[model samples]
Target: MPVDRKSLFKRVPSGIPGFDDLIEGGFPENTTVLVAGGTGTGKTTFAAQFIYRGAELYDDPGVFVTLEERAKDIRREVKSFGWDFKKYEDEGKIVIIDGVSSSVGLPSEEKFALEDKFNVDNFLRYVYRVVKSINAKRLVIDSIPSLAFRLAEERQIREVLLKLNTILLEMGVTTVLTTEAPAPQEGRISRYGIEEYIARGVVLLDLQERNIELKRYLLIRKMRETKHSMRKYPFEITSDGIVVYPSGEIY
Candidate 1:
């Protein structure tokens, strides 16, 4: 069947206090964006807020695929910000997958066999089922790097993610997959070259320390086929949630 042209440019609000304005609205339809940051940089929080906002403001059902943390732990962590994940669950607007599974090592008596290969295949399966069931329009996969590392080989990781993005885009869902960026002084960009290259857009969150004060900056590195805010904008994670400072304050 031919694709529908009406699916294009149907903007969905990001739900972050200050982010939408920076992007001149929100992400384009059916595009996968990479949100990369380090520890304590609010990557998980940002993703949750994005999903939460989608469910509440836009009535768009969403799905969260967690690789490292349990579903309950994620709920508790985000509750501090007053986001009621339980309520969203009750309304059937959100679904959380606990991707943590056990693995066993092979003994000398037995040839090597993966008892539970919790690779991207399993992740993709769960995502496919959840999205199809809910007819979800927005998705978030927190910490794609951890999942890639568990694959234990660069080629395997790249291939899995490349295919994963292709599948998600075909579903016409705007998605964000989180990754950890390399240190700035190294003069390198994201560690996963292929993933970064394949994604339709990339938004980088940077935490900089000056004297005793810590500041946060968000930079849109790339947004193919769309206009994006080029400057490094200031953002904060507070009791309410993430708020992107205006262009004047960012400078």
Candidate 2:
């Protein structure tokens, strides 16, 4: 069997509003994008909305690999936005892998083994099979930091991520990875060094409390082969989902 590397490069339509407009036209044909942010910064909402938009608007089935939450809980939480996860699941459009189960279900006797505990290789293989089966073009890993922490060494983590990104990109699926910032400080967002460099694009989400106003901003730090808006654009998490304002104001 041979992999047609060229077959994986096809334009993917992003369902998010202002976010896509900032980066020319969504992500590249086949690229891995990192969306790193802290808690309460709307990372899951953004990723969910993106995948929902893909299924409902673009007719592309997407896979969401969540490492922290349950699939049912995620559906319930996002229901206020009118994203019917059950409907999508029934229609065979959206699929969620319960990484929480993998992470927590380590042996009672054995403390931990990165692979024994959270085998991302199995996860990737499953995603690859599903993508090929359904011809899926969009994929997301809710958070990669969890996987990184489980790995004992930095080199091993980087090696695994590098290989995963290469294979996923080679498969021609436009992917997004969600990562939590270590702390609310400069250069504290992404710890794994090669994430930003290796990934085709990077989007940073920041939320800060100033006096009494809680402001949220989205910055397109890097996007290889594309001209992107470099401003820290204001955004909000609404009942309808994430909305990035035209001007730097919370609308």
Choose the strongest candidate by lDDT: 1
TM-scores across all candidates? 0.87, 0.85
Q: lDDT value for candidate 2?
A: 0.74
Clashing pairs in 1: none
TM-score leader? 1
Segments of candidate 1 deviating more than 4 angstroms: 1-8, 101-116, 152-154, 248-251
Q: In model 2, what lDDT does residue 232 have?
A: 86
Q: What is candidate 1's CA lDDT for residue 62?
A: 91
| lDDT (Cα atoms) of all candidates against the true structure | 0.77, 0.74
For model 2, the stretches where C-alpha displacement exceeds 4 angstroms are: 1-11, 106-117, 152-155, 183-189, 249-251
Superposition error at 191 for model 1 (Å): 2.1
Compared with the true structure, what per-residue lDDT tens digits does model 1 show for residues 193-230?
66687788888898887567888888889877666768
Model 2 worst lDDT run, 10 consecutive residues: 106-115
